[model samples]
Target: MGLGRGLAIGTLAVGLLVTSETPALAGNGPAYKDSWRPVKVRVADLLGRMSLDDKLGQMMQAERLGVKSPADVTTGRLGSLLSGGSSQPTPNTPVTWADMYDGFQKAALATPLGIPLVYGVDAVHGHNGVYGATVFPHNIGLGASRDPRLVQKIGRATAEEVSGTGIDWDFAPCLCVARNDRWGRTYESFGEVPQLATEMSTVITGLQGTRLDQPGSVMATAKHYVGDGGTTGGVNEGNTEISEQELRAVHLPPFKAAVDRGVGSVMISYSSWNGVKMHAGSYLINDVLKKELGFKGIVVSDYNGVDKIDGKTGFTPEEVEASINAGIDMVMVPYNWQTFIDTLRTLVQQGRVPLSRIDDANRRILTKKFELGLFEHPLTDRRFLKTIGSKDHRDLALQAVRESQVLLKNDHHVLPLLKHGKIFVAGKNADDMGNQSGGWTVGWQGTSGPVIPGTTILQGIRSSSSKVTYAKDGTGIDQSYDVAVAVVGETPYAETKGDRPQGMGLDDTDLATLQKLKDSGVPTVVVLVSGRPLDIAAQVGDWAGLVESWLPGSEGAGVADVLFGDYNPTGKLPVTWMRSAGQQPINVGDGRPALFPFGYGLHYSRHW
Candidate 1:
C-alpha cells in the first residue's frame, strides 16, 4: 500500500540504472510501465499523503511479536517486522506464520497508500521457517563447490520457497571472505578467496532472477558489509585491524560484485575495521561504497549495529546521523524499533541531522519498495503457503547434501559403509537433528534437541543398511563390528562461542569418543560436521575413514546415500584442515605450508 507503484530496473546489470537526485522510486498512480525508474517519485507521493507518524513508521524494523501489544502493529511508523531463527509465533505453525504476515501487512496497508509491511526471517537454508522445508548445506558447503552458478541456483531455490511463504526479503550471501579459519562464521563465507566471494555475489542476482518484479523471487541482501569476516582472534563483533587499501581490495570485492548485480540492499557489519566500528565508518559507508563503488541501493544496519556507533566510538547520535547521511537507509533494531525511532527523531529535531539526510535514507528504501513492485501485488499465493516444504525442494536439498560431502580420508578401504555388515553408529551427533544442522538452524546459534524434524544419521543409516545400531559410546562393538561410523563435529553455535573448538577439532569430544570406539576394536569411519577444517590428522590416522560434512543441514540423510553405496562422496574440503589453531588463515591458495591442503578430497571409485 505504501510504495504506491513499484520501482524498476530494465536489465540485470547495474549499468542499466538511471541515477536520480535521490534513489529510485515508483512515483504515484500505477506500477511499472517500464522496469527502469527510481522509487522516489512514488515514495514522495506516498509521503505527501502520510501523517508525520506514518512517515516515521517507515524507518524501523522489529520482531513480529516484539511489540508490546497487537495494537503496536498499527503504531504508524514501524516499517518492518522479523522473526529471527528462534522467535516463533504464538501457535508456531505454517498457518500462524501466514496469519502473522497477513495481519502485519493489513496494518500497514490500512494506511492511505496501503504499503505492505516487510516481514523477514533468517531463511538461511531453504524456508527453514516452515518446519519441513528441505534445508540444504550451509554457506560453507556451497563455498567448497567453488561454483558461483550453483550458489546462485541454490539462492534461486531458496528465494522461491521463501517467497512462497509470503515473505519478500532474505538476509543472505554473506560476502565476508573468511580470513581466519577459527572464526565461528568460517562456514558462512564462500571460502577465504575474494575472487570466489565475488563470484558468489551472483547468488543475489539468481535469487531475484530475470525480473526483480516477479512474485516468486525475493530481494537478496549482501550482508555484514565490509571486513566482518576478517575479525582478529576470530571473535564475533571483534575489530579488524587491516588497512583501508586492504579492506577495499580484500573484503570489499564481493560487496562491489553485489552492487554491480543490482542488489537492492546491503547490510552493514557488526565488527570494526582498522580500530573503527564499521557501524560508524562514514568515509567507508558513504564515501567509498556509496559514491566510489557507485552503489545505488539501500544500506541497512545489522542487528543492533547502529547502537555500537556512539560518541565513545567517535560518533554521536548526531554522528550516527552522518552515517545515514553517508549511506545507511534503514536500521534493524530487531527487538526495539521504538528506541531507534525515538533516538533518530531526537537527533533530527535537535538539528543533529539535516532534512536532506533524512530524505536520502527514506528515498533509498522507498526506491527498493517501488522497484520490487510490492505495492502492486501485496499478497502472495496463499495456496503455496501450504506448500512450504514440498517433495521437489527436498530432492534439491538432498542433491546439495550429496554434492557437499567431502571424502577426506580412505586408508586402503575404510568406507561405503558395507551394506551387508553390521555398522556401529557412535557419536552425540549421530542421532540428533540439531547437532548435524550446526548453527543458524531453528535458532541463532541453533540448539541441542530435536530441532524441527529432520532425519538423523542413525535413522538414515538404519533405513539404508540391513543392520545398524547407535550409541554415545560404541558398546557391544565386538559382536556386530565391521565398521563404526563415529560421526562428530561442531555443535549448534554462532559467532564467537561456536568458533572456539577449545583448541581442538570441532567436536573435540569426538576425539575421546572416537578413541573409545576405536579402542573397542571397531574400524571407525569418522564423519566431521564442522564449518571449517579442524586439525584431526591424529584422529584421521586412528580411523579407517574420515569425512567432512561441513555443517550439512536438514537433508543430512544424503550422507547415508553416499556412505551406503547409493551414491559416491564427491565433496572436497573447501578449506584446509589445519595442523593447529595457530595456523590461522592458512589455506591452499595462500602458498603457506598446511597439515591438509585445500581441495584435498579423495574419492575412491570402488570401496574395499
Candidate 2:
C-alpha cells in the first residue's frame, strides 16, 4: 500500500524523531541485515533475495524532483537520490535536509528486502547545498596552499557536514588535472600539474575517513574519470583530442591516487576521449578503469551522461545498452529515471546486457552500501549538524584563504598598509561575500549579493585598520589616503557560463575603479578576486602591489591577514598567468611568454 501524502516532515535542526511505525527487530530479517558479517557475504545473501526489479532499481540514481513521493522509493525499489546543484528542500536549512533524508530513507526501508538508499550530493567544497555551511576555498585556492593535509582536513569537515544531513556519498575531488585555465571548471581543479592533483587525493581519505563505517564519514567520488581537462578549446564536455599516452601521462595519475586511497566511487566524465564518448568507451571504462586500475568501486555516470552517448536529444535503447555494458554501474538519471530502469530491464531480459554485468553493478553498489553501514544506521547523524558552520570550520577556512593569496606584483613593497593610516577600499567585489566565494556556492552560477554569511574584503580592511573607507566605484579618494585598495576582477560564475569566449580583460566597472585609484596619486594595491588569471598586464604596471586572491571562500579576514603582514603571503599561482587573452591555453612549458610563470609567488621579505 502507498504511504500517506503530505507527511509533514519538519526541520531537523533541533533533532530527528524516528516514528514508532518503523520496521520490526533485525532478528526477523535475513542474515544480510546482520551488521557483523563480512560485506561481501552480506552482499551475496542480499543479492540472492532481490528480484530483477530490485536489481534494476539499485542501478538507477534519481534526482529529488524525479521521485513523486517517499513511497515511490519503496515501490520502485530505488537505490539512490541526489540533490542537483541548486536543488534544496523548503526552508533550506540543515534541519530541513535531515528531515528530507529521513523521509526518503524511511520509504526505502519499508520494502521487503529493506535495502537503504544511498543519498548523494555535490559537496565539492563543503556541504555546499545547505545554507550557513562553512564555505571553504575552492580547489584552486586550496591548491595554492600546497598542503594536502589541510585539504584532507577540509574534506573531513565537509564529510561531517554532509553526514549530519544523512548524505552517504559526495561527488568531489575533481581530479581532472586541468590542462587549460580557459576551461570554466579550471577553478575546480587543484592545479595544472598532475602531481598536484595526485597529491591532493589526501582528501579522499579525509572524506571516507579511516573506515567507511566511521561516523560522519561519507563515501568520496573521484570524478570526470579521465581526459576531461585536456579538452580542445577548454570547452566543457568537449572532446579531448590527445593520444592515449598523453591522456595516461597527464590525466590518469590523479585517479590512480584516488584508487590508492580507496575512494568509494569514480564518476565517468561527460567529455569524450579521441572523439569517442566516455559513456560508451568500453575499453576505457571496463578494460582500463575497472580491470587495469583495479577500481572495485561503483562507476557512476555524470548527470544525464548516458543520454549523450549517441549525441542526441534523448537516449536510445542502443545508448543505454552500450553504456551499461561499457561499465557504468549507476546511471545518474536525474529525470526520466523510470525509462532508464525499464530500458535496462528490457536489455537484461533480452540478453543484450548480461546477467553477470547486472550482478556486478548490484554487487559493487551493495558493497558500498554495506561498507557505509547504511542498513544498520539509516538516519541522520545530527551530532554534526551544529558543526556545519561552526567557528572551528570557519577558522580552518580562514587559514586556507591566507595560504591561497598569491602575491603577483609588489613594486617597492607598498603593501602591508599601516593600521594607523587613512586607507580607501573600492571595487564591486570588495564588500561582497558572493563574489569572494565564486561558483558552486549557494546557487549554481553563484550570483553576487549578500547570499551567505561571511566577512567582505572591505570589512576585513576596516577591522584591520583604524582609518578606512569603502567606495563601490572609487569615489571620494585623494592622496590624503596613505593607500587606495581596489578589490576588483571577475565576479561569480561556473561551468560553461564562466568560460571566457570573449577577451579576458577586466570589466569596465573594474577598469574604472582601477583608473580612479591610479589617478588618485595614492600608492595603489589591486587585490584580484577571480577564479583564474585574467588579462591585466597593461594596467598591472600602474599598481604599486597586486595580489591574486582567487576565490577565498567565506574568509575575507584571511586576505586581511596577508595585507597587514599578520600572515606572510606564500600562495603561488596554480595556473599560468597569461600575457593576454589571445594566449588562451598557455602553460609553463608551452614555449609561450607568461606574465607570471606557473608556481610564481612572492613574499614581503623576498627579493623580486
Candidate 3:
C-alpha cells in the first residue's frame, strides 16, 4: 500500500481540516505592572539610579507578574514575567494577553526611565501561549528536512506569531544535539546529528530577524547552555557524563552556530557535564561559553536552576554570586525572589559580588533589548489577535504534519490506508491531541481530556474513513474489521515524574494492547506518540504497519491524512529508535548499536 494520489488527497484533507478552530489559551486577566515606555537611554540611566532592591528586581523572571497592581513597576521593582505554558493570563483571550503584557510594561515604565518589561514565554514551537499561533514542525521534523532555510522560515514564523502577541523574548532554537533518543525533550531538538543542529541554528536568523539589534524582533534564546541532550540513561533532567572535549565535538556545535549568527540570549541547562551543573560550573558557563565562544548575549538560568547548584555543592548565596562572577547574568527564579534579592544584596554589600558584575549583567540584558529593538517597538499589534489561528498558519502546521509522518513499518503493502477498508481504530491515543503533542503543548505534561480545541486523530480519521471503530487501552475488539490501527505511544510527561533511568521503554500494557489486536489475526497498524523513541521492539512485531509520529503538532490530522493514503509519509527519524533502554543514548548517526542504524526509515511505496 503505497501513497496513492497524495497531492490530490492532501489538498482535500487540508481544505477540510483548515476550517477547524483552535483558540489561544492566554487571557488578559487583571492589570499587571511594568508597562513602562521609557527611551532606551532613559531606561539605562534609570537602571543606574535604582537601588539594590530595584536592580535585583530587574533580573528576576517569574511564572506570573509579581506586582498586585499597576503601581508596582517602580514601587515594587518587578522586572519580568513569563507564562510557563499552563500559566495562562487571567480571563485568557488574545486581547487580555495583550492587556496583561501592556500592564507589565506600564509598571516598568512607571520607574523614572519608563523602560519596557521584556516578557518571555516558551513560544518555542509557536505562539504556544496564544492558542492559534502556527504550531510548526518540531525541531526534529525540521532536522529531517535538512533545510536551514526552512528552519529559518520557521524561526521567522514563530517570531512573528510570538511578537504579534506582545512577547519580546522567545526561549527557542533548542540547540541540544539530541544524543539520546530516550530523552523526553527529543522532539524539542533539531536531531541527533551535529550538522542538523548546525543547520537549525539558522532559526536565530528568523527569531531575531535579519537584524540582530532591532526592536519588534523577539530575542532568540539558545538553550540548555551545554550538554543537556546527552543525559545518562536518556533521563529528562540528569547528569551528562562526557569529557569537555567530547562535549565540544558533539553537543557544542549547534550552540556555536547560534552564537556565530548572533543569538541574543543563552539559557543555562539543569543537567551537569563532568559532575558540574552547567549553571554552577564556572569553567563551562563562564570561561567557555561566555569568553571562548564570544557569546556577548545575556545568559539566563533554566527555571529554578539556581536551586540545584546549592543542592549540589552545599553553596550559599555567596557561592551563587561566585557563579555569577563566573559568567551567568540573569536568574529564572520561578519563585522565592526575596531570597535572590537578599542574597545578591548581601553579596554585593560584602563585596562578594561586585557592582561591576551587576552592571555587566544589567548591561547585557539592556543591550539585547536594544539589539532586538524592543525599546523602539515595545508593543505588538494586539490587533494581530485577528490572525492568531489564521488559515495560513494552520496551513503551515498541516504542511508540517504532512511532512513529519515517518513510515516505520509497511509489510506486504499493508499501509497507505484505504478509505474503503473496514478499519477499527483502538488505543487511548487515537483521538487525543494531548497525547499527540506530548510534553509542552498547552500544558507541561499533557493529558488526554479537554485539550485546547483542535481536531484530533480520531476526529480526522472518522471524517475521512467510511468505516472505523474506536477504543481505548482495553475495549471490545472489533471482530469484523479488515485492519486495526492502535494509535498509541508515550503520554505527556517530563522531568523526574516521567524519568526512568533504568530499563526505559513503553509499558507492557501498551504492548499487550497491540498483541491483543494482532492475536485477533487482523493486520495491525501502530501509530506511536512519543517525546523520545522507546523500547518498541516488543511491540513492533505485533503490528503489521508501524508509524513513528514524534509529537506531531496541532496538525496531527495530517498524520491521519498520510496514514489513510491521503498523503505520503516523508518524515525520517530525527533520533534513532533504540531497541531497549540498554542500547540507549541512541543516535541514528553515531555510536549506535546494530539494531537499527541512524536514518533507518521506509518511504511509502505503492508495492504491497
Candidate 4:
C-alpha cells in the first residue's frame, strides 16, 4: 500500500489517541513516549517508529489560513502551522487565539504517532499579531538603547505573551546587521554593526528560557540567516555581492552568536550571496551554518523561501530538492503545502533526494519537539493567558520606549518642557497609535488610527501637562503657546513596501505642519516617529529641538517621559543618519560624512 493509505489505516487502528493530559502508554510503552528519556534517545526511538509519510508530514509547515480543515492537519500529518502577519482569528483576542491553537493541536495528536504540532508565529516585537498584546519597540529602537539585558527582559515578556497564545516558535530578534537604512526591514534589524546584533542575541535565551520545556518558554528563531542586510541597494531579498571574507566579517557573527546561545532554530534568508540564493546555497547553509558554526538546532526556511530558490513565482520539484538538500530541515510551504509534500515524497522515492537527508531533517525537528515537552503538554497553558498585555508587560514596554528615545538636536535645553506651559501638539504621528507602533503591530504592514490599544504621543503630552492642544495638521497655532511639538515621521510599512529607493525625507504634509509650528515663533520640538533615520539636514536648522523616537510601540508615555524630564534622553543612533538620500548605504568608518554619526546622542545637560 502507498504511504498515504498506510497512514490512514494506521491512524484508524490507533483509534482516538490519548490526549496530552494522559500518557499514551503505561510503563511498557515505547521509549519515545516516555518523558524521562533523554531528548536524543526519545527522538531516535520516535524516528524508528515513524513511517515515511509521518516523516514527510513533519517536514511540511502550512499557513493557518491555507489548511482546508482540521482533518488536513491529521491526514497530512502536518508538523507545524503559522499565522501570516495579517492572519488572525475573528475578534483577534487572546482567548480566541488560545482556542484556535487548541483546536489545531487537537488534530495533530490524532495522528498515528500522536506527535504534537509546534505552532509558529512572527511574534517579532511582543505577540504583535494579537490585539491588546504589548507592542514593544522594534529592533532598531532597542539597538539604540544598547542594553542587552533590557532586550532579554523584553524577550522574556514576549515569550510569555506568545506562550499564552500556545505558540511554540517566534521568528524574531532578527540578527540582521542592516548595512543600509533604505532596506525596508531595517527596523527589524538590531543595528549596522555585527557586535550590536551579537549582543542583542541574548533575547534567544529569554525566549527559550533556561530550557525549552520550562514553563512560559517558547522556541526562538535567529532569522534571515547570512547576509540579508548587506544586499546591494538595500533591496529586499536582493543580492549581496561581497567577498567571502567581507561576508564572514560583517554578516556571520550574529548567527555564530545565536548558535552559541543554543537558539532553537535559524531561518534561511531570502536574499542571496554572490548571486546564490541562500535557500539553495549548500555551501553556506550546510557547510557554513550547519557544519562550520555547529548549529545543531533546526534550520527552517523563510515564508515560501524554498519556492524562490528557482527564482520563480511558484516552487518546482528542483526547488524543493535543492532547499531540502541545502540543510533546510523544515519548509514553510504556507499555501501550497500539499504540493510540497507530494513533490518531496516523489523526489525521495526517485532517489533524487536521499532518505538520509529526510531522516536527518526529522531527527533535528523531533529533537526540538522532545525538548519542548510537547508530548506531555500539547495544549495552551492558560496560566500565561492572563499575562498577555498585562500591566507588567506594558510597564516593561514603557521602560523600553523611554530608553529608545535618541535626543538628536536639543538646542538651549528646549526639551524637558517646563511644568507650566500651554503645549501645542501637531503632525500626523502625534496622536496616532498605529504610527507610533510602526509596522508588525496587529497587522502586516500595520494600519493607522488606533489599530491596537496604546497611548498616543499627543495623549502622553496632554497627560504630562494640564494645558495641551492637539491638531493633526498644525492649525490654530501662535506664539501664545509656549512650545509646539510636532510628532511627525514615516507611518506604518514593512519589508519591500517600506524600502525608500529615492527621497527619504519628510513628506509634504509633515513639512507643512513643521512650517506651521515654525511660523508660530514658539520653540518647536520635532519628535520623529520612524523605523529608521530620515533625511532631515535641511530642516534640522529650522527646528529648536529634534528627537528620534524610533517607533516606540504601545508606550508613547515613555516618549513623554523624556520630553518632561521624568526620564533623561540616552538613546544613541543605531544606524548612520545620512545627510541626503544620495549617501545611501553609509556606515561608520566608511569615509562618508553623516548627518548624525553612529552612536551619536545628546543628554539634557549637554547642548550643541
Candidate 5:
C-alpha cells in the first residue's frame, strides 16, 4: 500500500489526480510536494526522500556551458544554473531567454522528485546581460543620486524584466563599502560610506517585492561578502588587512541591512580577510552571519570562490571541506560541477562532511524554493515581458542619470551651456554607449562602441542644441566655437582588470585630447566618463568646468540635463578624490590631504 519513498500509495495517487499543469498545483501533491503545507514540513519530507546524489546535486550550481543539454538538469539532478557576464542564448532575444528558462525548467521537472532548478544572473545594472533591456546607471551613479526610492524602483523594474525571462535569482546590490577608489569594483558600490550602502538595501525590497511568491518578484543576492572593498593595494581578490573593529564598522552595515530586509541569499567573497580566505572563514560565515546576525537564507559561494582557498589552480578536497564547514550552503563550481558533486559525495561518505550539514543545507535551499512557489509556477510569466526597456523605466534611468552628475568644478560660472551656441564635442567616450555604461554591460569587462541602445552623451548634446560638431581628437575647433566639451577618462573594465596598481593617471590618448582642447583658447568643459575618480589634480585647474559622470549607463541625457540648467547638480563624492596616486588608500577620517574630500559636490547658485 506504500509508495516508493514510503508515502501511502492511495494518498499519493489521490494527490496526483487533482493536479493542474505544474507538479504542486494548488498544493495538491504528496506531503513533501504540497505547497499549502508549512514549508518546514515540506522541506523535511523532501529531505527524507533524497539520496546522496540528489542532495549533492541540490547544492551544486553549474554554468550553462557545463550542461550539454537541457536533459542535463535531470541527469545530474542539478539545482541551479547561471549565465556569466558574456554568456547568453543564441540570437539573444527576450524570447530566447524565456525559451531557455522553460526548457531547463522542464528538464528539472523530469527528475524523480520534480524539484525545480533556480536560475541566477548578474542583472547588476538593469538586467544588463540582456540586449536592449533598458540599461540604468551603475551603482556608483545611483550612489551619487542619493535616492534609495529611485534605486528601489530600479530594482522593481529589474525584477519584472528578470521574471519575464523566467529567471528567479539576481546577484546584485554589491554592498562593499569601497575604502579605496583604486579598487576595480568601486563602481559596483553605492558609495564609500556604510550609510549609503545600507540605505540602498531598499533594492532588496524592490527585487523581492512584499513577498517572494509575487508575480514580478525575484530573489536578490547580497554579494562578495565581507572585505572585498578593503583589499590591500586595491587588488582584486587580495587581502583586506584591517582590524576586526574597522571591518565591522565600514563593510558590515550594508549586509546587516540586507538581512533586515530578508534577502534570500548571500554570495561569499573571493577576497581574503587578514591573510585568511573568506571562503574558509568559519567565524564570519557560520558564527557571525548565520547565528549572530540571524540570516536564515542560503549562503552561496562566488564564481569558483573555493578554487583560491589553497592558492592553487583548481579547487581541492581540503578547500571543499573547509568551505562547506564554513557554512557555504551552495557551491558555484560554474564549470566542472560534476566533479564538485562527485567530490562532495565522497567527502560525506568518508565522514569528512557530516550528513547533518548536508541535510541543513538542503533544508534551507528547499525552503526558499517552496516559499517562492516554484513548484506550481515553474515556467516563464510572460505577462511582464512588455516591461523590458519600457518608456517608464528609461525615464526613471534618465532621472537617475540627472541626479548622479556631480559638478566638481564650474570655474567662472562657465556651465549651464546655452542651447543656441556653437559647441565642439570630442573624446573617445563622448559618443559611445559602451564607454558610458562601463563594465558588466554587453560583455564581461565591456567593450567600446555602440554595444546596446541608449542615448550617448554626444546625442544628448546634439538633441539640446542646434549647432554641435564632434571630433574624436579635439580637432576642427577655433575661436569661432563658443566652448569645447571633452569627454575623456577610463574606458570600461570590472574586477581585477580595473585595478590600477602602478599608476592611476589618465592614459596618453586622454591627456593628448585634453591638451588639444585646453590649448584652443575656448573654455574647455571636461565631462569625465569613468568608474572612479582619477588622479587629475595636476591639470584640473586648467579646465573651465569639470563634471564627474560615473558610468551613467544608457541615459546620457541626464548629464546634458544638468549641463543645460534643466536639472540642478546634486551628486556628492562617494569616495575621496585623490590628490595623487600616492594617496591610494585615503578615506574620510584618514587625515590625508585630498584634492577633493568625500561627500563634496557643487550646485548652481541660480536655480532654473
Candidate 6:
C-alpha cells in the first residue's frame, strides 16, 4: 500500500493498541513512525502521507497567547508555537514552562496524523525568557573574552536549561557583525569583525550537541540573516547599502560559519540589502543562501517578517507567495496565523504558489522534527528541570562575568580596590539586577528591580568586603572613604527602541552621580554597566579608573571579583569606544581616533 494509505490504517491501529508508554506504532506501521530510520527517509515517508492541510499547517507558527485553546492546535494542525520575549505562563517557573510546552505538544499530537509540534523561543542569552534561568553575559561580553570554548560550554548549559523546560528550539547565536556602537542591538553581535562572530558560532555546536537527538540538545538558529548591523546611521531594520563584496566580507561570514556547524535554521533579517527587503529577495534567499551557501536547513521568517515585504502594515497574498517562493520555509505569523493558513491555501489552489514549494518546506521542517526525536519523545523531559539556574550554571556565568570585564582606564594604579578599605558605591546600576542584565531578560524589553534571582553588583561588593557603603545618587560619599565606585550606564532596551541615532553619552543622572563621587576626591572609579560603548571621553579625565562591565547577567559577584582584585581584568573591547558620537561607526581599521581603541584593555599588573 502507499504511505498515505498505510498511515491511515496505522493511525487506526495506533488508537486501538498503542498505550501511553508504547511506541507510536506497532510492528507493521508506516516507515515514518519507526525510530531507527534515517531522518531524511522518515521525513520523506511522513511527507508522502500528509494532506495539503498538514503541509500548510507545518509551515505556520503561531504565538502561544494567540492559540485560543488546545482545539486550535488540533483543528489547525499547527506545527509550531513561540513565546514572544515577554510571553510566559503564570508563575513563570521552569516546571510551569514544561507544563505549558507539554500542553501544547499534547494538543498537537491529538491531530489525525499525530505529527509532533516543535516549540521555539528566543532563548538568546541563556533561556532568558524563563525566570530563575541562568542569564549569561550577552554576546558582546562573550566576544570580549575571545573564548569560543567558553561560549560552546554556555550553549550546552543553556540547552540543558531550555530542554528542562521542554523547549527544543532556540533562536539564538545572532551572527550579525555589529559595525556601529550606536545600534541598540550591538550587544547581540559578537564583535565588529566577522571573525569574532564566526568564532562564536561554536555556541551552535554547544546548543545542538554532537547530535541533534542527544540529551539536552536544542536546535540552533543563525539569525537576522545578513547585514542587520551595518545599516546606515545604525538604524534598526534600515537598509544595508553595502556592495555584495562588502556584505560577504563584513556580514556573511558568521552565517557561513553557522551553516558549516550544521545550524538547523536561519532567520531572515528584517533589514534590507540595498533597498531590497530580505524577505522578498529571491536571488539572495534562494540563489545565495540556499544554493550558494548550501544551507539545507529551514529558512524561517522573523516575527511578522513577511508583513513588511511590501512596506505595508499587514501581510498580503502576494507577500506570502513572494516570501515562500523566495525560500522562506516557515512563517512566524504570531497572531493572525489562521488568516495566513487560509491565504496560503487559497494561493496554492489558485496556482499562485506551487505544491513543490510546499513539499520542500515541509521536507526541511519535518527533517528537523525527526532528527530531534520528537516522534518518540514528544513531551517535556522533566530530567533537565533541575538544571535551570542551578549553582553550576551560576558559577559558569560568574566566570564569564569575571572574564568579560574590560578595564579601559586605571590612572595612578587606582583599581584592585583594597579589601578592607572604606569603599562607597553609588549609581543606578550598582544594586539593580534588571539594569545589569539589560534586555531579553524575564520580560521583552526587560524591567528594573529584582526581576529575577541574581546577585546585584552592590551585593557582590558587600559580600567580598565588610566596608562597602552604597548611595543611589552619590549621597553620603565623602573623602573619608578610601575609594568610591560609581556603577552607571544605559538601562534595559532591545532592538528598535535601543538604537541611539543622536547622542550616545552618559545621561545627566549618571554624569551627576559620577560628579558627586569625583567631587569628593577619594580616587573615584567608574564602572560602566551598559550594552554598547557610551561616549565618556568628556569626563574620563575626572575619573581615577574606568571599567566596562558589559551587561554582566545575574552574577554581580564577578564584577566585584575584578573590582576587588580577586580576578585580574582580561576582557578586551569588542567594539571601538567612540571619542564622541560623531565618530559613530568607528571600527578597527577605520583609522578614526577612538577614545579607547578596539582591543584596548588594561590589567592591574601591567597598569601598576
Clashes of each: 21, 2, 34, 0, 0, 0
Residue-by-residue lDDT tens digits, candidate 6, 112-145 = 8899999999988898999999999999999999
Per-residue alpha-carbon lDDT of candidate 2 for residues 320-397, written as tens digits (9 for 90 to 100)? 999999999999998898989999889988999999999899999999999999988999999988889999999999
Worst 10 residues of 3 by lDDT: 24-33
lDDT of 5 by residue, 1-608 (tens): 12334233323533544324544334435666666655665676677778989999999889887799988899999999998899889888888999999999999999999999999999999999888898988899889888999999999999999998899999997999888788899999988889999999999999999999999999999987898999988888999999999889889989999999999999999999999999999999999899989999999999999998999888888999999999999899889899888888889999999999998888889878987889889899999899988899999899999999999998888888988889999999899999999999967899899988999999999889989999999888788999889998989999999988888888899899888887889999999999998999998988999999999999999889988888989999888899999888898888999998989899998643
TM-score of 1: 0.90
**Regions of model 4 farther than 4 Å from truth:** 1-26, 606-608
Better candidate by TM-score, 2 or 3: 2
Candidates' lDDT values, in order? 0.73, 0.88, 0.71, 0.90, 0.89, 0.91
Q: Candidate 2 — which pairs collide?
A: 12-95, 13-95
lDDT by residue (364-456, candidate 4, tens digit) is: 999899889899999999899999999999999999999999999888788878768889999999989999998998889999999989888
Better TM-score candidate (2, 6): 6
Find the candidate with the highest lDDT and give its number: 6
Which pairs in model 5 have colliding backbones?
none
Q: Give the TM-score of candidate 3.
A: 0.87
Q: Per-residue lDDT for 45 in model 2? A: 66
Candidate 6 minimal-lDDT segment of 10 residues: 11-20
lDDT of 1 at 391: 70
Candidate 5 segments whose C-alpha is farther than 4 A from its true place: 1-28
Residue-wise lDDT of candidate 3 within 344-396, one digit each (tens)? 88898999888878877877776666565555566665655665667766777
**Which 10 successive residues of model 2 have the least lDDT summed?**
2-11
